[model samples]
Target: MAKISINLATGSLQQEEIIVGIDLGTTNSLVAYINPEKNPQVINDMGRGILVPSIVHFNEKGDALVGNEAKEFLTTDPENTIFSVKRLLGRSYNDVAAHQDTFSYKVIDDDKESLVKIKAGNRFYTPIELSAEILKELKSRAEHSLKTPVNRAVITVPAYFNDSQRQATRDAGKLAGLDVLRIVNEPTAASLAYGIGLDPSEHKTIAVYDLGGGTFDVSILAIQNGIFEVLATNGNTFLGGDDFDRAIVHYWIESNKLKEAELQANPGLMQQLRLKAEEAKIALTTQNIYNEKLGDIWCSITRITFQELIKVRVQETLDSCKQALKDAKLKTTAIDEVVLVGGSTRTPYVKQQVADFFGRQPHDQINPDEVVALGAAIQADILAGNRSDILLLDVTPLSLGIETMGGLMDVIIPRNAKIPTKAGRQYTTSIDGQVNMKISIFQGERDLVKENRKLAEFDLKGIPAMPAGFPKVDINFLLNADGILTVQAVELRSGVKQEIEITPAYGLTDDVVEKMLVDSITYAKSDVAQRMLIEAKSEGEQLVYTVERFISKNGQVLDEEETKITLVHIEALKAALQDGDKDLILKKADDLNEFTRPFAERLMDLAVSKAMKGKSVD
Candidate 1:
């Protein structure tokens, strides 16, 4: 007789390993795995439910609380509770400045171009760290429920996520102690869960419309011979179910004659109203009217009126669908199927609208919320060599990037990304009257390019002479199926272009690639710290230059005391930049920003008033 190990917690035969699938979502997250019965199933640990709210709260002890435990802090301690962190990942301060106020927590904007940071309590955190906490919770739940060690995973991201965002997701998973085997697109995963690509013989062109709590994206996918190729993707990162909640909140405020100032002053009431609005949005889905009240504030809406409020917003998503089709260069008639994903699709109007637009009924057999995770599980099984019929996509063995300001390795195509892919990012010159831009390509995982392997270098010649940050340089990397890389650089404004080809893995053996990967992980902490410091110094230098130039031109606009204070702050930042302390440099830069913001606004107002000096009003 042969003896087999058993998992006491699950009362099942223990496997040697398990590669779980994780949907690290905006509003909620969940983990799934292929069970012993060869079925993809979500883990519901201790009956706590499958969906974990993507929220993290920092307590007085400075410990992080995630998921359901952190949900309550959204009202009681909004400043310490972080939600919708996915929106901030791989985004600069300028990228999300307009929407920063929507987040209750403080988002640090040291420089407009650097990645956004969150300040919860006294400590500053990147979106990657916050997301890691959520991933850790999911990992713990999966391990507990499966009664096995789960160290590897397949994570999903939005279809429109760029290389930086994808890399950020992978780093977050690494921080959570999981070796991310692949980053699958959410729409692609959703299609897999619906069994659309289970059969290699199946050929179809489908559209996946995903509208989550904080994000919306429509992806056009063409499946042929078990390969899922994304033709195009379009959506607004900030437009989603949250906007629907906001619409209801605005209607209530207008209907009840509530003051915006009062709501701003009373956060608890605002949170209550927001939450109630969310409830009403859900209730109106099945009922004709949803009526409720919090204290003296009446929250009321009819299904008809609710739909009317969100009609424009819903139309916006439909327009995105149209744009996606246009980008894919396909007609509505070309679409063989439409898949509805995300919890927002539960709304009757959204489903019907998508169905009508596609000229066919959409697929929603799988739960919209769990579809992506289940699909990820299936993919994980394939990666684990359990499925042979489905083909596993080939991926790049290492990250591919270029050297940006401060010699930072700005990854444009991350490691483990599916091959035969292309991605690009915009860049700008750093000096005045710059005519030529250097493009240095590298392959490795280090934060700085000098430590990575340089693949090629070239210059984008004939750039029109212009001031710093004026030229729009787009660098694109296209990796073909045979492991050949083609890099193209173009000055978008002038159409001055340059292209080069290189073999990314030429002369590199498996051991060398493996060593590079190991070295990157070993130095991940120090590399990130060094990269952040360099970015801080670069930001400080840019700020100093901008402030000095402003002072030189607009000295007369400032009073003596104002000018004196501004100069002092500028000098402080310069001094901090001279030192190597990243935090101090950021602190001084922030001080300068705070001091100059009011006068900056005043100067703009004066200019506007002068321009309108005898003009008639609209």
Candidate 2:
């Protein structure tokens, strides 16, 4: 066999395609790629450092500046500098309504059900659009550093992210002009960076505790045959190192005895104190105490006090660890390794507590903040098919589908299907002469539609009117490699079609998703029974409507006895609909349909005959 030659200068594989990995974080974001040396490396553009503050600012002319450039305006133009945008991604106004006071920038409360929008200067921006701005900057930095046009990337999200949040990330990547190859979970990416699943024959189980600036999650993963599977994930989207900073701020405000009204009135002073608190939090990591001053205000905090303030917060994260273990159906002893991933894990107290809780020393050799990105780069390399020894597969955590009649969830892609998969099912009109079909997409494992989370809704119009159940409406769900979904609805006979990319920009809150899953498990039997009753009730109601409408139009054509018999059947169905009895409702509806079929057919034949009387045979 001929030996492959290597170019040592650029450290890139021969004829290799460069694909970057991105950690589009809440507080900061960065990009990385595998170098020609075959090692994953983060791009440092013009020596600007690896971490880019995920902040954006707009000027009077409405020009946008991102990263470090936009960080300075957080104090000077607090209303225009947007930060912590990742928390708002895939979130509705109501989902973040409780934390509205945290942002200095304007988060417009347009509609509770709609996605949150930020008002910068005179423009309104969705989180997907805003996140794209940050991703674009990361893209530019990668191209500048690597001296190549980088177009494809693997992006990481929290392990507990619902389908909506994951899709929102993919949309942002698309908006940023990057072909997002995969949406990797932070825990899985961190594990990959640590080489936990690199060896195909070695099997391991681990827990990844990720506490970033604005979010925290603990994931239990089982790696077998070089394939990593996420068993369970738990955490809060609003808790992180930023909260530790805030705890210091709260202590200083009390130490100085400063009035809340004063801080509220003076945004500049608040920003100063906030920034100072951040400094103290970092300084106290090594030093016993931290002290500083801002004008007339004194900022002081001891390491002991700092730890005390964050004790409950740290415990909350540990509580999540317990829950993750519980959800995974594994004891802590089952975990063979514990990995740390996130900037906040640098805190000595956090590291010690995590270690104590796990009964072992957690792996922190790699930089917590950069490990996720590095892992993503490695995944990109694998996707490039450079590594034959590794195999990684990701699955959707919840079932996804559309709402059917009687408020039932008709699952198309069930939970645990491998990503980049496609599934479809055929549906039909519920009523005769129905020309339009409404498709409402939902995500959850519940039997009833109302019990699940609604992702998006659209109408498949222009369907040809036909007898009930005669039209075939094929609904297909295409989930790409990135885990983003595109829904297509087609009328097979007429070729009338409608399709929508399901981007849940205003997604449900983290708690709601978790609750939906739990409820699906806890109340599965009741939900199914409720669904059947609702279906029976719906059938009865529809039959009543049809019978009444028929009488209004053709009562004169029928004899008195026929009209009376039809009225009796309609009454029986209506009574069954009210009684809430499934079997009785179905029986009554069927009785009415059977009684009226002959008359309905006779009327149709008569109408055709009348029309034919005035026309010649073709």
Candidate 3:
């Protein structure tokens, strides 16, 4: 009877859900939607909460595991598990080659293309495919949680990510079978989450300092009633918690006399060490010392010592902050409140440094880890026309230009310039009877071509082969709201247009991504066990090297009881290594590290006291 009289306009079926926002990060990824109540809620996958670790693991059954489950296997099955795939997105083999030693994955050179090949059992897969697997998981999560098909989304990226990187991110979204409406910068997304609204007078200027798991970004924004405009943004794509982990790992190795060769042989050892180092860094935020038994390694690390080792990195974040302020032409005092986003900001030392720099305490009102995703959701609402009172106008983080006559970079769009902007330059033939014009695009603030990040290269053919400077070619560079570059060239004399189909020199191509998926699925079964063995061997080596170094360097200073404890840990680790039980080796490593806690604390206190004396000069 109700069906006969029901009006569709008054029923639940009458309304449709709009768009959603996604933060596709290096360490983690999340999706959120704006509900009918105008509240942003994170969508969970299969009853799990928000905040999915951006990781993927290929199991022996040819099934792919993503999120937290995948991250758990990172050290245990490193060869089959891939994390931090975001860093390699849109990057060339050469761009990531020098830093291959830093990542856990194996990078293979395929002619000119650099491929991230994950070895599992008897098979290997590329980075792009692995990334797609993660994306697919995310898509499924959103669809299952919302109980509605998620066809469109607004994904956020690093402000400093170049055109190629941006394109790669878009490709990933496409592979996941979702329509990517727009690619917003991470920092700008955070500002939207703040809900400054479009009142220019209320918040004239604001700064977003984002230190995420694998990257750091600083963005200066100016809000005019409902318009959140990004004035300038800059950051190190490779700097963040990951760097801090490496710094501490370096300290652990040097202090314990860990040999480089041993670490090379046992890759899993480094992963374990990195995990411990991260824990120590986090613990130091609230306590004076971090004490724990890592597997078999007994270690006590002091906050003061950890701070000393990471001070330079902390300073670097501040430097980026200052530069952002300078770019906005605003003083530190002009900033009403400094908004800190990202898990790294949880560090007390980092918070204190930011306070001292701005002469004010940073706002901790928002959840550091969830703020970016929240902001992205807010932007999604605005883009879907669900929220009209908010507008986000973000800028390009780096300067966009082309190479000039002397191998110099000529800026067409200066860094920090407003978005949806276009600029054009005219070029003439270099030599007599020149047939075509060559254009090289770069993204950076450097005056020299080599100093900037090369984006793409294209040739404008079909020139009339005119004498030296007769033919005129108009080159135009267009930067969209998402900060991607679209270039075009027109031969003025013949009204003929020639343009280059720009592909990122560093990121994955569409064909490559498809190939990776097939390979990952094919080799999933055999790779799991082999990957574990390799990782375990690596962890064992790291433990042995660290203990040997610690004993050699601090032996003379240890008392009888301390020496006995140290010896016990060392002997345990050594015994485990001999047996080739990766788990046991790790357990012993933790015990040894714990035994040296007291000594590490004492050394840190002394070092801090000495350093403060130098810093206190008026």
Candidate 4:
């Protein structure tokens, strides 16, 4: 008898493998799996406990440390110990600029279009890389606990995470030596932890209100026949238990008449107070009063005063719940279940307020911190074809794309997109009288096609000759239920067309595919660094080209000093690109853009005014 395989993400045939579930959190991370007993269990990593602090520290010799070992550096080595990195994922300088100072470590302030990076030791690390470090720790824990080579997983992220953030999470998993099959939403996973969608004939509408250490989001889901669909989600990524701790910190500071500068000057004192506040938060959950001091720093608060200080934050969450309900077109009474998730849900006041608002006690029999991971394990089981009660729609594992000019990867169907899906984007020629347009298809997360796996290529011939950026070319990707990909390109003006069918994994053995997956994780850091460098260099080169062209075309519009300053900054950016530092290149790029933005806007206004003169409304 021959054995058949299954592709966990797409439901296509492939080699079977054990799939783990991961919850890559801001303050802590963990891994879980459906064990031999057919129960989802969190990996303890030889009695180290479940919650692995989402922290990384560098030693005197620059050796990276993760989890509990890194936790000790929070106060001693605040500059090199990074925590709560999830808030920085897929974010730019402008995204978190207002609160950048809150971080104990340095966050690079550069181009708003570029993703944020942090400075730790001699190197710069993006949030994706920092997050991958945490995931790597979790992966090791799972492998040690299972005593097997754990290579595949289903990871959970916040429902409100945008495409970039979701992709970043997937990339982090890849970097952590795991083939991320699916990126399940945290709220959906929380619901699954309680077996809310076990019965195929059942129907329910529920709200998952998750307030974790660093983020909060409330999702309204409708479950019918084991299918969970999110109706609405709303919350603050910057709001959570961390804010509650800060409330205590600030209260103590005010009561003691301590200046903000004094607290800021003593890193050890701040970290101690923060830890004390955390202890106090947990203590008040079971006790009415928390009175303690950390190295002369008082951390004392009554349960009522603690509640009073964070009452506004809790109300903000309630307002978000109301907004989510309103958007879902459902009332509080219509919600059948209110699921509380995340470690912060242990707070009695938070629980009571939610109960009061919904007029029902929240469902939290399962541990809030582990709920998402447990749910993810259930999702993995479904993917493994272990659950006949639930049906899963087909999906694509990696994004499918084609190579564009400057070696950029232009995506057609992003990863995790439902199969039998068709999405197209219009393109245009970059040069005058351009004829043939080559379509090179590839798949993976990197921004450049060179870093991804190339499937095939074809050319759309007989395009009507036209000026640059004028020819309308429509490129479409149609993926079938079997995972076969068909790419088509057509010229709307001339009706010239070309198409190709690509079997994404054609002729690739299971070991080869597995090797590729492992290779992606092994070279993850260098690949991401290379990709960022390429992106910065590409943008800088393009800007330099545009500035040169603009000077050639409209040099008369600028003063000598303006022209000189612009040219000098352009040269500086060009030099920074060769410095081989992605952050520096991006910084210079931002500087140049800022210097020219006002003058460019002024020039545009003048041209528009000149064109609008004597023009009247029809």
Highest lDDT, which number?
A: 1
Better of 3 and 4 by TM-score: 4
Q: Estimate TM-scores for all models.
A: 0.83, 0.65, 0.61, 0.80
Q: Candidate 4 clashing pairs?
A: none
Q: What lDDT would candidate 2 get against the real structure?
A: 0.81
Model 4: weakest 10-residue lDDT segment is 1-10
lDDT of 4 at 322: 99
Candidate-wise lDDT, in order: 0.87, 0.81, 0.69, 0.83
lDDT (Cα) of model 3: 0.69
Error of 4 at 141 (Å): 2.0
Summed backbone clashes in each candidate are: 0, 3, 50, 0
**Model 4: CA > 4 A from native:** 1-17, 58-63, 72-80, 104-106, 257-267, 293-298, 408-417, 421-440, 443-530, 546-618
Candidates ranked by lDDT: 1, 4, 2, 3
Better of 2 and 4 by TM-score: 4
TM-score of 4: 0.80
Off by more than 4 A, model 1: 1-16, 60-62, 232-239, 242-333, 356-359, 433-438, 458-465, 491-500, 598-618
Query: What's the candidate order when arranged by decreasing TM-score?
Result: 1, 4, 2, 3
- Candidate 3, residues 1-618: lDDT per residue as tens digits? 111111111111112455778888888888888877888777776667678899888788768899888888877878777778888886766788888877776654431232234445444454555666777777788888778877567788877777657756665665566545567888777776776543445755777888988888888877666556678887787789888888878877886777889889988888888889888888787889877765555556788887888899889888888888888888988877578889999988888898899898877678888887888888777655565554445644445789876565666765434576788867777465777777899865344567556888888777887765578888888877655678998989977686654432245333433333233233333332333344444444554565566667666557888888777777777787789664455456546655666775775676688788885411
